[model samples]
Target: MRTHFIAIGGAAMHNLALALHEKGYNVTGSDDAIFEPSKSRLQAKGLLPAEMGWFPEKITKDIDAIILGMHAKADNPELLKAQELGLTIYSYPEFLYEQSKNKTRVVIGGSHGKTTITSMILHVMHYHNVEVDYMVGAQLEGFDTMVRLTEDADFIVLEGDEYLSSPTDRRPKFHLYQPNIALISGIAWDHINVFPTYENYVEQFEIFISKITNGGILVYNENDPEVKRIAETAANPIRKIPYHTPEYSVENGTTLLETPEGPMPIEVFGAHNLNNLAGAKWICQNMGIDEADFYEAIATFKGASKRLEKIAESSKNVAYKDFAHSPSKVAATTKAVKEQYPDRTLIACLELHTYSSLNAEFLRQYEGALDNADVAVVFYSPDAVKIKQLEEVTYEQIAKAFNREDLIIYTNPVEFKDYLFNLKPDSNGMALLLMSSGNYGGLNFDEVKKLV
Candidate 1:
């Protein structure tokens, strides 16, 4: 197949391009701008565009398909030319569905925990030497690319994100994957820019459930009232399996799970992670992995990148960076760290970077989210709000929204770094968690590590 991609330097887009290229397809792509990691990865694969900008001339009659990325505007010249040529164009999710139509698609979906669950499934499958094509959101330890497609693979694991498919395709990405087996971890309203209202945001997941094929299976978190309601009300002809926080105990900074293989210690800790593991285990069971095998394989699993990832640690201090932007994720991460180190003083810092988290109305949802932290700090860039075209937020507004009078807030990165450096490491063991979807404006982790 000959494929061309418009705005292909995106995280998922670049991975898809590489997957297609590796699948023996003649792949080419163009983007107006490409950033690090994506650029380097594409270059390494010889899939990077010769130049950075789109060219209408690149869309030719021989191109079999054009995969569109969310980053592309509707008026992109390459996209216009592809349309003019009457060539098949697909959003990233649409193309994925097309590629995996013959396979049993297992899509893991939720506002959060989707990546971790998907990664766990992939990790277990790899450990068992189960060959399957997959597409996960994060870079796993052994995976070459986030996406993999093959002609003979009978199964495909997809991290089902509820975000928009593309600028032109208004549908949520998860709705495109008509999974035979699906999982929804939890529901919390997000992507305020697209959904606008909480009700509107939830309707997307409902649509996702409806899209599942007949006789499909849905494994959802029973603890979340919203998810439970949706799973129960869905009229689709499918099996609904509800899971919750698994049986586990934390002792001496270690979490062990009670499984058929007896008690097994796992590197990843936290109630949310345990919940994710249970969901992954059920999905694996459906795929023919026994409880004992799942437990044995999962015991060796570390974690997905940036999800409570330990960056630096010492006797006195431990530092972690997490991709936690939503209120639920922030709360879960904070509580997890505190539970793991009950005697430690937890100093948590969260960055309000996502569109939903930056919204004035959504900010209130963060009330008591960071209450688990002994000292909580919130950071937001004024420039970020301006870039998002959101209502200006003041430190007082955030402080009031969180309902924590003692909360520390920073609008400047340098000052935040200065404050961190000035604090002496607690003698009684302290945990420092820096949570955000984005790096805190290029804050130097190595420098922070040295200071702490």
Candidate 2:
């Protein structure tokens, strides 16, 4: 197969390009600007575009397919040429579906926890030598590539995101999968730019549940009221399995899972992670992994990257970084860290980076998100707000929305860095958490290590 990609330097786009290239397909791609990791990875695989900008001439008649990435604009020249040639164009998820249509597609969907759950399932399958095609959002320890498409795998596990598919395809990416097996971890209002209203955002998940194949299975988190309600009301003719937070205890910083055999100590901690693990276990069982094997493999799984990842640790201070930008995720992460180290003084800093988090109207959702921490700090860049073309937000607006009079807020990166560096953590234990989809204006982690 000969495939060409428009805006292929994206995280998902680049990974898919590499996967197709690995599958022996002649792959070529173009992008206006490519950043680190994606830039270097594509270069290593010889898949990086020769020059940065799109060349309409590259869209030829002989090309078998064009995979579109969300990064490309609707009026991209290459896309126009592809359309002019009447060539088959597929969005990233559409192409994924085309490749795995013959196999059992297990899609994990939710506002959050989808990445961690999908990673856990893949990790267990790898541990048990269960060969399968897969696509997950985050980079895992054992996986070479985030995406794998094969001719012989009986199943394909997909990390189904509710975000838009592409510039041309406005439908949520997960809507195209039409899975034979699916899981919805939880639903919280997000992507305010696209959905506009909470009701509109939730309708996407309802559509996702309806897309599950006949006689399929849906594994959901029973503990989440919204997820449980959605799973029950759906009229799909599928067997529904409900999972809740499993029995566990955090002893001296190590989290132990209560298993039928005995207490199993695991590397990952937090109630949200444990809930995700339960959902992954149900999906793994449906994929042919027995209970004993699932627990055994999961015991060794660390976690997906950037989901409560420990970046710096010491006797006096421990710091973590996470990809949490929404209100629900922010609250869960803050509570998780504080619970794990009850004796420590938790100082949490959140970067309001994503469109939803930075919006003045959306600010109220985070009213008590950082309440678990002893001291809460929120950082956002006015330049970022301008870049996203959002309405300007003031310090008073943020402070009022969070409803915490004692909260510290920073709009300048330099001042934020100064506050972090000047912190005088005593010999008493202290936990520091940094949460955002983007860095706090490119804050240096090396300097963060000196907090102790």
Where in model 1 is the C-alpha error above 4 Å?
none
Model 2 worst lDDT run, 10 consecutive residues: 443-452
Model 1 steric clash pairs: none
Per-residue C-alpha lDDT of model 2 across residues 1-452, encoded as one tens digit per residue: 99999988999999999999999999999999999899999999999888999999989999999999988998999999999999999999999999999999999999999999999999999999999999999999989899999999999999999999989989999999999999999999999999999999989999999999999999999998989999999997999999999999999898999999988999888899999999999999999999999999999998899989888898768999899888889999999999898888899999999999889999999999999999999999999999999999999999998889899999999999999988887667889999988878989777787785
Which stretches of candidate 2 lie above 4 Å from their native place?
A: none
TM-score of 1: 0.98
Best-matching candidate per lDDT: 2
Query: Model 1: which ten-residue window has the lowest total lDDT?
Result: 443-452
| lDDT, model 1 | 0.91
Q: TM-score, each model?
A: 0.98, 0.99
